[model samples]
Target chain A: MSEHDKNTRHLARMQRKKAVVDTKIESAKISKGLLLIHTGIGKGKSTAAFGLLARALGHGMQAVVVQFIKGRSDTGEEAFFKNAANLQWHVMGDGFTWETQNAENDLASARKAWDLVQACLQDETVNLLILDEFTYALKYGWLSIDEVVAALKNRPPMQHVVITGRAAPQALIDVADTVSEVNLLKHAFQAGVQAMPGVEW
Target chain B: MSEHDKNTRHLARMQRKKAVVDTKIESAKISKGLLLIHTGIGKGKSTAAFGLLARALGHGMQAVVVQFIKGRSDTGEEAFFKNAANLQWHVMGDGFTWETQNAENDLASARKAWDLVQACLQDETVNLLILDEFTYALKYGWLSIDEVVAALKNRPPMQHVVITGRAAPQALIDVADTVSEVNLLKHAFQAGVQAMPGVEW
Candidate 1:
């Protein structure tokens, strides 16, 4: 087809698409907050959550992050965002469950982190809350999934929550407004590539 | 089993894991660079790339971004990273191909963007290069896959490259050290949730 004809057809198609998209956008009127879940056996779940925190901060929104399974406070995200005045950071886990070596200790740490997250949920000023690696806590039975879901449902009306980890529970998935599963296609670490400092952490 | 016994078993398991992880880390001595590809129908491919850029910047590394299929500069990532001293940002595409309506114009824009990316690839100081939504250009025949692969192979030894989009070509996947497919388990947009600012820009 000639360029002009092609262009005219494309414009017509887009006009049809615009009508549909505009109607959808207009129909979506309930925008108080969102419960977003990122999970699966992939590498970018937590990284995606951190990106959202950056996005929220760009809009001058207050964000609070509570890490549930990672013990270290020196991740690349922490190195930069911990100093942000609008962010409240908490790294409360002892480590991975197998590394912690005690179920009671892991449970206690999870409980403590949840307490902090609850406070953040109650804070009217905190616009976004990130529960990093939280699904691990639920999967390991470190925290009650029912209680967590209840609390999330009862959070401030305008507070957005992002939960990131692997193997999210069906209950959590059901309650989420958006959910993404990042699947692993290939990994360098599997092929003898060590995790690089800035890239992995 | 008693709590102490369970704890002891956990410690032993972790010790074994530590030894294995340490040996793997030690064996991975060569660190030239990484060709990481994030492609799928899921939501976090570009977000994950942005997170990597943030991580690189946290380590004081320079990054250059060439957006291949998106034209809008009002994204949250652009709003934040464009001002960063270490980042060289380029929004080169004329928007999505369907939106642009002219294949010649789209091909010309893609070629221009590739030229800019080639310059960045040659620059030793650019530690990270992000080609956002680049796979579309190759898939649409706007650019040559062989030439893109050859240029990537010849990039600076220590410069990392991240390519993000859905349906990445097999050739690109073969050359990449890491590849992740972000599968769409569920999307809010499909459920009548409109894309919100700062969350889906």
Candidate 2:
């Protein structure tokens, strides 16, 4: 064979080897124990978290969602997934702490809700645990940061946890494996338009 | 009662009325320009979009999502939500023309895909439309960008569109009201662990 042909073949072989190595590297990811904190002043923090829950359910994975500071007004999420076998929905506490007053009382209820989530995490039956709007509790000093971190650390080795709300605590940020901040630049409502039925809710 | 007590009581009542008014304004928001596009080399774009479908369903609002290039994987989000009176799931296209070499054949299939979504955009029954991986087609020049934009502009007044893919056209970026770019900075896989079943699926 020719010298040029030999060099060309050698380069091709190297390229193929590199690609195989890359794929192998990608396929070996930890693939479990993901703790996601979606924060910042964006409107879609909760929306993004719920989007994750839906993904988990579609894959036949179990999801336990505990919604804090959002127990009223009947958010449509519950109405639709109420019957889905893989979904466990718990809405505890009044719409907001100010509404329920006694921040101390609200804190106890938040802790109780966390306890329910802990059972799912410990049971290893839940694939995804979404603590929707839990950041407010941390911000208001209703939930102990150490307790939250400890429970999360103790989650089933292969399970994932997603916490969504604005102003996430630094403590939560420190422990999260994946942190995404959705910053809201502009919103439709601010532009004098109302959220239409299907898209907004 | 003293005059001071009367003044304090009056101020408190006015504040309560103001609070009620603020909440009404907040609840009255209707999302029109809000759009969600999922573009990444991840396993969950369509899964995320479908989850949005369930959310819209819960709210009693209509949803119309056009699945592009994924007609074969049809595991049928259509079969799941199509029967619901308020849900409109449109799955168009026959897998993809990727392996097909002829330019004419590719364009022909693209045209077919466009036809289904184009009509749905006009129908008022459709509330939200998801263009799954449709961006890749346009990026590859199989579909015309002009035609796509025209369809988007001509859609129902309040209709929201969600486009997902790895590389969406520049025109799309210009037209999109909200765009989120998920940058893959690091992956745990490089270290070595296979994606866990329920977690990574």
Candidate 3:
């Protein structure tokens, strides 16, 4: 085919694509709070959540992070957002589940974190809430999945919630407006590479 | 077994896990610049890249984003990071390839963006460089893969580069320290939901 014909064909294809996308975009008229889930055994789940936080903060949205199992260490994210305006930070993790080894203590800590999550869910002023590693709490049965899902389902109309962790509950997944599974293709850690300061923290 | 016995067994297992993780961490002693790639049809490729940028900036690192094919729309990310200190942003795409419809114009735009990329690659002051949607430039033959790989290979020792797109070249993946493929199980857009201001942009 000639170059001109190729150009014509491409334009026609794009026209069709644009029409389809426009219809889809138009069909989605109702905008309310979104429950987003990021899961799977891949990397970037929490990282992607933080990216959303940054984006939210960019829009002058008030945000809070309830770290369920990662608050023990000072991460680069915590350092960066420490004094960021219009932001609230809360760390409620004792440590990793295996490291803690005490189910009662883990349960207590998880309950404390869930209380904070409940407060965030009720607060209309807070535009975005990140429940970091929350799935572990559900998976380990530290928190009641039914109760948590109820709270999430009844959150403020315009408050967005993002839950990040592996093996998210089907109940939570069923209620989410958006869900993404970050699949692991290759990771440095698996290859005997340590998680570094900014890269892995 | 009793709860006490279960806890003890868990503690032992955790100790073993700690030893294994610690050994891997210890083996990765070298600290240097990393070439990371986020590819596949996953949702968080650029989102993950931005998360890395946020982490890099959290550490007081200078960063730059050379957006190749996302220059058409004024995205929430751009609005949020436009005035961010210690960061530089450049939008270098005329539009998506099909929208542009002219190969020569697309190639020219891609080349112009490549010039900016080359500058970012060569500048040691840039601690983190994000080549957003760069794979399209390669897939479309707007830029040479060999030249891009060569520049990436010769980057400064402490500068981290993140390439976010789909179908990343094997040559590029071969040089990357970490690669993630975001598998799309479900997308809101596919469910007739429009991209929102801060979430999709």
Candidate 4:
């Protein structure tokens, strides 16, 4: 095609796309709290939650983190945000399920974390709440799916909740405003590269 | 099952899992730069990239961000990290391709961004570099895939690079050490909810 003809075609395509996107944006007028779920077997479910936490913090909004399955407190994210006045971070896990090994103990921990989540859901002042690795609790039948969904549905008007883990329940998925599944195509760990600090954890 | 029986079974499973994970961790001893690609049609590809940027910055490492198709400088991330002493952020695109509409202009802009990427690849002091929405340039054929892959392959040994966008090329995937495809199952925008600041942006 001639250069002029190509430019005209490109312009027409863009114009059509712009009109559709603009209409979508215009129609989307409602604003309120959002339930976001990050699930699947890939990395970055929790990492992206931390990014949202950072964005919330950057805006100087009140944010809370209740890490369910990550026992380590020495992660790069914790070290960075633990000191922020607007942030409240709780690393509330014994360790990975395999490391913990006690169903009763895991249940107790899940209940304790749920207690905190309940409180946060009621507190209208909290703008963003991250339930990191929360799906395991639900997946293992440690937390009641109905109770959890009800509490999430009843959260304050503007509070944004981010739930991250693998195998999120259908109920939770149904109620969530946004859901993303991070699928692993390739991993450095499988290629004999260690999961390093800062990048992985 | 009895509580005692359940506990014993859990303990046996835990032991088996621990051994496998330990072996995996032990065998992965190679330490080097990582090429990570975050793609698929999801909400958190760039958000996760920002999270990595935060983690890198948290470690007091020198980091840089070359945003490919995002033209706006007033984004929550740019607002948060623009002034960070450890970061060098350049929003290099005119806008999204549909918005820009000029192929020649976009090609020039992409080339300019590629020039910056090449410079960063050689900078050993830079610990992390985020190429946000970089796949679009490759997808649209604005940049040479062979040349881009070659540059990425030759980057500084310890400089971590993150490339985020949709429909990432197979060539790019082949070169990446870690690849995650963020699959979008649902989004608030589709439900007529406006994209709010500090959360969506």
Candidate 5:
């Protein structure tokens, strides 16, 4: 096609797309807190949650993060956001499930983290709460899905909650307002590349 | 099963898992720069890139962000990171394709952004470069995929590059060390919930 003809066709296509998008944007009129779930056996579930935490912090919102599966306190994210006045971070797990190797201990730790989450749910001042690797707790039956869903349903009206991990339960997905499955197509580790600091940790 | 028996079984299972995971971690000994692509139709593609930017900055690594399809300079991330000492962010597009409605203008903007990207790729001082919404440029044929791939291949040895957008080209994915497809299972906007500041921005 000629350049002018191509440009005209492009303009027409864009106009159509614009109209559809505009209608969608216009239809979305209700504003409220959202429960978002990031799941699947892929990277960036927690990373994306950390990104939301950054955005929340950038906007001067109070944020809380509860690490349910990751036990390490020396992660790059923790080190960076530890001193932020608007942020509260709690690393509750002793380690990964394999490293811990005790069902009772894991359950206890999950319970402790849930206690804190319950408090955050009631605290309207907390704008964003990230439950990192939380799906594992539900998947492994360390926490009761019914109770968790109940608390999420009753969270402060303007408080947003983000849960991240692989294989999120159907119950949680049913309650969540937004759900994104991060599918791993390929990984560097499979090609013998080590996970580097800051980018991976 | 009895609690004691359950505990014993869990321990055995964890031990087996630990052995497998340890083997994988041991095999991955090489450390190098990674090329990661976040694609598919879902939320957090750019948000996850921003998260990586945060992590890079947290570690005091020099970072650069070249937004290919987002023209607005008033995003929460930009507002927050504009003053950071080790970061440079460039928003090159006039707007979304539909909003702009001009192929020539969009192509010109993409070319201009690619120029900056090429410079960053050669600069070893830049530890991380986020090309947000960059897949669109490639998908629309605004830039040559061969040239982009060559530049990425020849980038600084220790510099990590992340490209985020929907439907990343096969050529780009082929060169990427890690690829994550963010699938949209559910969205708040679909349920008539408006996008809010910080969380959705």
Candidate 6:
């Protein structure tokens, strides 16, 4: 090949490399003081959300996590991170939602849950708010999406909120700065297995 | 409801809870060891991975981190983690794959990279091994998956390993007793933004 042709080939390769680099460059800027909602049927919605809380804590960002459906379980994550000086962790739910039936009871508990969330959202000191399993309230029709979104929109500026659960509403998706849909390709439960601690919880 | 009926309901609830809990009791002993790998387009994989390393250090677990792909970045994580007497940190790859696409060079770097991973994996003294961007080797076909798997499977049997990245392979997934996937939804890029310190990196 001619020297000119070799130069052209090099240029093309550079372009291809830049394309990948450009995407990375673009994504790096996506979550500046972001508001993220994690929803899906797959497991680990809570786990992944907590993972972010760890990041925020590592950076000295104050984080508050509200566990809507996991209030009763002795979560390993709670045992590990709840005591971090920068983290404000609350196991503020009445265990799983399946155990709670009466709409009155659920909403009452959600209100209590929302209070803790509101405190975190409004607190200038708290940089990250993890609303664990908050979506299930909307999915079960126990909480109004409009009301929740309004609360989120009106949240104190610079505060990032993370919602974790399945069936995130379109309105939620619309307002979210970032949305991660975790698909369940395969889970141990499908094979007649159960959650394994340190791995599952 | 009558007082007797209320008592009966409460007793039944407790009984049900115990039966469910009994079946779910964890018999496998929980071990505290550490292995961390950070990779992906996301901002904090390395930071978050190292946060866990710090936690391990607090627990007095032996740690060694080898930074691949991001060797020259000199992230604060490297500076902080390396200062701890219990932690060992190495940075390699010089800059990036594109900066030096020579296969022989990449392999040479990878061999050096693997040397650290292999050392931590084998030396019974080191309890935690952080392989930042370790998966890039597998993704690029520079390292065989089976070789990596065998090393991981045999690594200090009780040691805990964390692999963080996008697009982890099926083989890794199979061997991972615990596999957590982080998803991305709404990012700041759509709004034209950048990552600030302590939040991004």
B-chain TM-scores per prediction: 0.97, 0.69, 0.96, 0.96, 0.96, 0.79
Q: Say which docking band candidate 2 falls in.
A: acceptable
Q: What are the per-residue Cα lDDT tens digits for candidate 2 across A1-201?
A: 785675466556656666776678566755566777767664555666666665566567788888888866456667777877878888876766445534456778888887787787797877888898889888877778898899889988888888878888888887776666655444555555565544455
> Which residue pairs in candidate 1 collide?
none
Task: Identify the candidate with maximal lDDT.
Answer: 5
- When candidate 3 is compared with the true two-chain complex, its DockQ is 0.56
DockQ winner between candidates 3 and 6: 3
Off by over 4 Å in 2: A1-31, A97-102, B1-35, B38-48, B69-110, B166-201
Give the top-scoring candidate (DockQ). 5
lDDT (CA) per prediction: 0.84, 0.67, 0.83, 0.90, 0.91, 0.65
Encode model 4's per-residue lDDT on B1-63: one tens digit a residue. Answer: 999999899889988999999999999999988999999999889889888877777778899
* TM-scores for all predictions: 0.93, 0.74, 0.93, 0.97, 0.97, 0.72
- For model 2 the TM-score comes to 0.74
Q: Could you report the DockQ of all the candidates, in the order they appear?
A: 0.54, 0.24, 0.56, 0.73, 0.76, 0.21
Per-residue CA lDDT of model 3 for A115-193, tens digit only, reads 8889888899989999988999999888888999899988898888989999998999888888888877677776656
The order of the candidates by lDDT, greatest first, is 5, 4, 1, 3, 2, 6
Give the DockQ-based CAPRI class for model 6.
incorrect
Error of 2 at A84 (Å): 1.3
lDDT of 5 at A16: 100
User: Which rank order by DockQ, best down to worst?
Assistant: 5, 4, 3, 1, 2, 6
Instruction: Kindly list the per-residue Cα lDDT of model 2 for residues B1-201, writing each as its tens digit.
Output: 875775466556656766875676677555463566655443344545665667778877677667666545325344445566676655565554432323454456667878888887888777777787788678767678998887787777767777877666667766666554433322334346565433333
Q: What is the lDDT of residue B100 in candidate 2?
A: 35
**Where is model 5 chain A poorest over a 10-residue stretch in terms of lDDT?**
A76-85
Worst 10 residues of 1 chain A by lDDT: A95-104
Q: Kindly report which residue pairs in candidate 4 clash with one another.
A: none
For B1-201, candidate 5 gives per-residue lDDT tens digits of 999998999999999999999999999998998999999998888888888887878788899999998887767778777877799989998999999999999999999999999999999999999999999999999999999999999999989999999999999999999999999999999999998887887
